[model samples]
Target: MLYIQLTPFPELHTERFVLRRLQQADAPALLDQRSDPRIMRYLDREPDTTLEQTTALIERITQNAADNSGVTWGIVRPAATQELLGTIGLWRIMAEHHRAEVGYGLHPDYWQQGVMSEALAAVLDFGFQTLKLHSVEANVNPHNTASRRLLEKHGFVQEAYFRQNYFFRGQFLDSIIYSLLTPEAAKPELINEAATEL
Candidate 1:
């Protein structure tokens, strides 16, 4: 596939939010986002239990971005104040395969507001347009209906289902794999435009 770097790191923007690289100052918000059981329910990792754990997570994400292995962005709405709403990222970036895994979480306060849906569209744009990725993948717990719906709305198709495939937090969980090819990723822009016309 031979994917080349488009930008070392890109700050993506949508009509209502900014998706930028995470920083140490965002640790408090990250802690809040990661610790929520509602947000962490389907994730493979445990709910972050401490500020130190959040700080460590920030460091790891920063390092991965630098290494070109992955990148995470803080979802910020910069209006009267720079408020962080959630986080989204492309991880396990496989340049040789031109693919990566997409992960995201939003504060419960902002859920059902179309915030994650908007932010993810921008991230997928960056992944396909900027990074030139051929496809993007997502692993969702089959029970997370809302999350699965969001992925489906973004044009990801169910590619596979693995029963009790992921061992996490002293239990195994079923996983449904979804994927969006670059061609499918392109529809979001047009979809947005069509929405605007109505």
Candidate 2:
């Protein structure tokens, strides 16, 4: 079985952004994204219409980290104000199986800008290297071509497609599953290059 520890809440940094813990202060920004129809369209959950809802969501994310069941990061640009541009996480952890599910959403303003790709690369590194996960999976709305493309760009392959497997908002929805497995070994040059990038 895999062992996991999320204490101290790992804060990851890439060239352009910082992946840090979500806080109550971030509720408003998060609400803006969660309440936007464009951002929430592919997500099954209802739009968060109130600050209270977003705050509760942050609280749950905190609890999940404390419980070591999951970890979520608010993606923030380092050079700019410390407002969240998006959010990402590894959840639905199956420690015995050394696997977890990846989920994310960005404010529409930040879309198509490679912001999520950077965040995802950092998270995947943490999931595989620090958490020792053997594989990571993503379940996406079938119509979310952008998400599918993003996962594929990160080396995730389509593992399965379930037709009308999800019931949401009075409709049955199809889901596409994508996955990436930890490589058996890292090439020396690749390892050194990754070391420098981080």
Candidate 3:
């Protein structure tokens, strides 16, 4: 269940976004996103983090790219301002099983703008069709209505809802797990739209 190695790092694009390798230089842009309380609460970093920490984070992302454990794609807006707005990646690749966990985050400024969904659509296609993956799963905080809706919009079902899964912001929070298989994906055009490579 280690399809990660076979899943060659591929560059993905859409009308407004580009999915490509994450560089250490991206730390500053990412810090802009990570600095927000909303984005950092569920994440491992705090809002008042240092540049070195961002560097370390980018290094970890680079390690993922080098180790081939998973592929991290920096979500960028390739228009007048080529800014790194967010990140979308596939991790915990179980190639033998042809499944992996997908995760994403975007700057609050870009939230509710369909940016994450578009980026995900591009990646899901690369995962299922190009890499031949069979399924993708996601874990979200139940309170994250926007993210939950995004998953549902992409055809991921609410497979599990666990209470008090992780403690954050000085309190425990519940988690909702979502999953979408190839068969499930095939039924929804949105899920399968980018699935067919160009």
Candidate 4:
């Protein structure tokens, strides 16, 4: 059977995380976590986001899902943790090339808990084994050491550092390109063990 037929677009659930489709009602939860400057400062946002914008963002994500171009999974703790931990997405899908760009962000409170890394391992596995993507790339602002560290921990190599690639806030910011080949991305068990030493 074709890989797509086997698992083209199934929901991904992990031990502690539920990777579900985003809905409009999710906006308020997203706003609650991301509206804070601490969470959005390094993000590529307008810095001022209202509930309306968050609602619209969810709509946009749903549209992408409809078009089959990409989808955003809202990461939630199934234990009724009552917090939107973060999001994991396979955006900028290039079906012809069998590749996609991966992006993620988390509530600052969830940092250092290994939640994002654990979630990333699941997504990377989904990308390679399920979606049959040949590679996955993630871009992060160079100044965001925490993000850089997370990507590196997941077997992603720093491919390039583009100067003044993104305009966040008032100034041009450098962006770091990180990528993991399908074979490399598949070795999450190893990646997780390695992450322990970092």
Per-candidate alpha-carbon RMSD to the true structure:
6.8, 6.0, 6.0, 6.9
Off by over 4 Å in 1: 6-8, 184-198
Cα lDDT, all candidates = 0.87, 0.92, 0.79, 0.79
lDDT of 1 by residue, 50-143 (tens): 9999999999998888887898888888672256788899968989998999998899999999999999999888888788888999989898
- The superposed Cα distance between candidate 1 and the true structure at residue 85, in angstroms, equals 0.7
Write one digit per residue (lDDT tens) for candidate 4, span 1-198.
222332234577888888877767677788877677787777777643699888888888877777777777888888754456788898677787787899887888888998888889998998888788888899887778888898889889999989997876698888889998989545779789889989
TM value for model 3? 0.83
Query: Tens-digit lDDT track for model 2 on 49-95?
Result: 99999999999999999999999999998876468899999967889
* Residue pairs clashing, model 3: 1-94, 1-95, 1-96, 1-97, 2-95, 2-96, 3-95
In model 4, the runs with Cα more than 4 Å from the true position are 1-9, 184-198
Query: Candidate 1 lDDT (Cα, whole model)?
Result: 0.87
Residue 182, model 2: lDDT of: 82
Instruction: Report the number of the highest-lDDT candidate.
Output: 2
What are the per-residue Cα lDDT tens digits for candidate 3 across 1-198? Answer: 544552355778899888887777788888777777788766643574787877887788777766766787888867733578889998666777888899888988888889999999988887887667888999887767888899999988988988887776687778888988875446777656767754
lDDT value for model 3:
0.79
Decreasing lDDT order of the candidates: 2, 1, 4, 3
Better of 1 and 3 by lDDT: 1
Poorest 10 consecutive residues by lDDT, candidate 2: 182-191
